[model samples]
Target: MNYKLLGKSGLAVSELCLGTMTFGNTTNEADAIEMIDRFVDRGGNFLDTADVYVSGRSEEIVGKAIKKRRSDIVLATKVRMTTSSNINGVGLSRKHILDGVEASLKRLQTDYIDLYQVHVWDHATPIEETLRTLDDLVTSGKVRYIGCSNFFAWQLMKSLAYSDASRYVRFVSIQPQYSLVSRQMDREMLSLCLEEKVGIIPWAPLGGGFLTGRYTRDEPKEGRMTTKVGESAWINRASDQNFSILDAVVEAAKELDKTPAQIALRWLIQREGITSPIFGASKLEQFEDNMGALGWEMPTEIWNRLNSASALQDDYPNRFIEKFRRPFE
Candidate 1:
């Protein structure tokens, strides 16, 4: 239930952010509302949703759920996806951003968004054009902060540099897919965010339920991985390396008398530069299990074990650079 300042901003948010991507899809409105209530009762203050989630139904459900305590919540949503049939319906162009924000505000039933992020990079539009539009949103009091998701290290650095030189509002945070099984961020994005002082609110912090101990080596017959699509596909998550990492999590859970979900989440919570890990639950029991990640600290020994098990393979210039630094150390 602890709070941390998001990036370099004065805004404080909970250690865990509730993700509502499944709301209005796998979870109904009543259940979604109940989940929000329980989360707030447990002292959580961050909620993340995207306008494209479930064709805006997720935003509607979240809007209704948080209506009573709007002032106490830090709401975040994204744009930059195809939302209409028209040719100008997508991308970070000024037209799309302006239209998207208006639509998001209406659906969330809020006058201003706590954080408005571009869901992904829009190469079609000039970076300056995209940043200028976001700057206008802040200037008009429609958005308090801006951020990006699914961006490469260079894309983020380019945006930050443009903002600094143009005197525009810089992105204060980023949302990347990071977890014990998905440590690709460790390659470059992690260092970039750390050096730039940008907060990281990781999505899929449990690897889309891979680290939850629900699947086996035989392959999942059902659940998200069975779809064989996106990052959570059976092909992507069924690798031998990921299973070894999951074994480590399961072993830690057994030793500590905690659930596998808790062990995985705690590792992320304690990792340096991780502001908050966004977790989504389709059921109350799942949400409760994720909550267990709080209220206790994982022993450093176990933490190091999980870290070593999931560490990314050494590659390229980084290995060469490290070899050179060993003598100096």
Candidate 2:
């Protein structure tokens, strides 16, 4: 396991972060603790959870699992999701940010969070109010760093600009959905993070198991996608093009003698500006299998093949710009 500095921050984190969304949900406390133990044994020091996951039960499980070695882990969690029926129970408003951090700290059994992130864009609150609240958290030593998740290019840039003007601690990282089959981040957010020096910790790095090569067209397996069929993203991914991409992954895996999950993760880990890929597992084998992605290198040929198979076409003016640059090359 390798560690990289998170964006421009001095903090170092593992290349692969253990995600605990499954904790207290699909996995019981004992299993969750075992998974985390294995992860730590494998040299993983980063763990990510959200307060909203499993209605706060996930946080409780993670808290118990990491309590013995809390000092050695780079613990991260998020706010901005609805935690209660109260009208002030959500959003990035000052009240919620203050209340949310307190709740997360209590649940995680930690005095300071390694990284505290805003889970989603909250347009209702003023950016100044939100930034000020996060700044306060850092100043009070409750949060060591701050980040944002599920933010678009514009929203991130706007927040950064506001932070600069107000002299607030800028977000050191951004978490977005990115994978071999989900390359939408390559368009704008990737470049934005690169230019701004923000570390990217990608969640759903396998496209919610789409790139795992475990699902088929006729009969999807009983997994996250199958259980969440009502979600439009999952429904939309069950397309001919996506399956073709999966086939590309399977073919490469077969040629290299690696699991499709390893191939997908290795490719994402090698991408520029990605600090870590947050992966979750319900079973211990699944967690162990994902670790396979780290031991060796994927051949360049296979990597390129997977890249081409999942590459998104250049959008809009960029497509035209590529045409213009072709002459110079």
Candidate 3:
């Protein structure tokens, strides 16, 4: 319900960005509109979507859902995903950036995007060409702000440096996967965003529902870590360590009189420089539950306890520096 300035931009967005990836996939367009109506009723004004979601159907529903309140919402959409198999159909190349924004604008039924983000790192394209095109969008009044998603610290920095040198539109935000169970961003990207003034709108803030406690120690579902994607890339593995972290989350949730989902979200909100997270929900109840994270905060010690349990192993110069500085102590 609270609004924070998005990065260096003067724009204000809600503490929770309503992500529409699940809108057109699991639910019909009508239901998607209903969900958005409920969200806006709850004081949420920020929406995040991607052109590639549901092969553009998601954007269509989202566009329609916000028709009555289009000017009131801070709408964000992403590009760089493969929308077509053709060589020019994807990536952050000038052609794709230009084509993709037009497609997204058409689908969203908006003349300008609140935020236009590169969906992921496009290694094939030079940073200059990609950034230069984003700059053009800003000049053309097609995009208010720019951001990047699923990018590493180096890639983010590389793009920022390119933008600075060319006087192009600097990325005002960075979206990366961050959650209680997945603290990889804490190592570098978070710090990079802090230093560079890039607002962080973390996606998969619940580790794709692993932290939701539905995948209990005894039960694993076909939804997330199971038959579809997991059967290939993921192991059916939650070691004692992972369980210990889950247990701590459950314990804290009980102690705080909140659900595990709330505890997970509250943990992120407590982090410095976190503008908001683009949390996804298939069910209305799930969306309502996530709202609890904003009403109050976990005590500092409890926050640190949860963080310590799920923190990632230090790497590189950080690992080397820790020996000299003793960060844990």
Which candidate tops TM-score? 1
Candidate 1: where are CA atoms >4 Å away? 326-329
lDDT of 3 by residue, 213-234 (tens): 7776664556656644441212
Worst 10 residues of 2 by lDDT: 227-236
Stronger candidate by lDDT (1 vs 2): 1
- lDDT at 148, model 1: 95
Better of 2 and 3 by TM-score: 2
Count backbone overlaps in model 3.
0
The lowest-lDDT stretch of 10 consecutive residues in candidate 3 is 228-237
Error (Å) of candidate 3 at residue 106 is 1.0
List lDDT for all candidates, in order.
Answer: 0.95, 0.90, 0.85
Model 1: per-residue Cα lDDT over 184-279, one tens digit each:
999999999899999999999999999999999998788998976798888999899999999999999999999999999999999999999999
Q: List candidate 3 stretches off by more than 4 Å.
A: 219-221, 227-237, 323-329
Q: TM per model?
A: 0.98, 0.96, 0.94
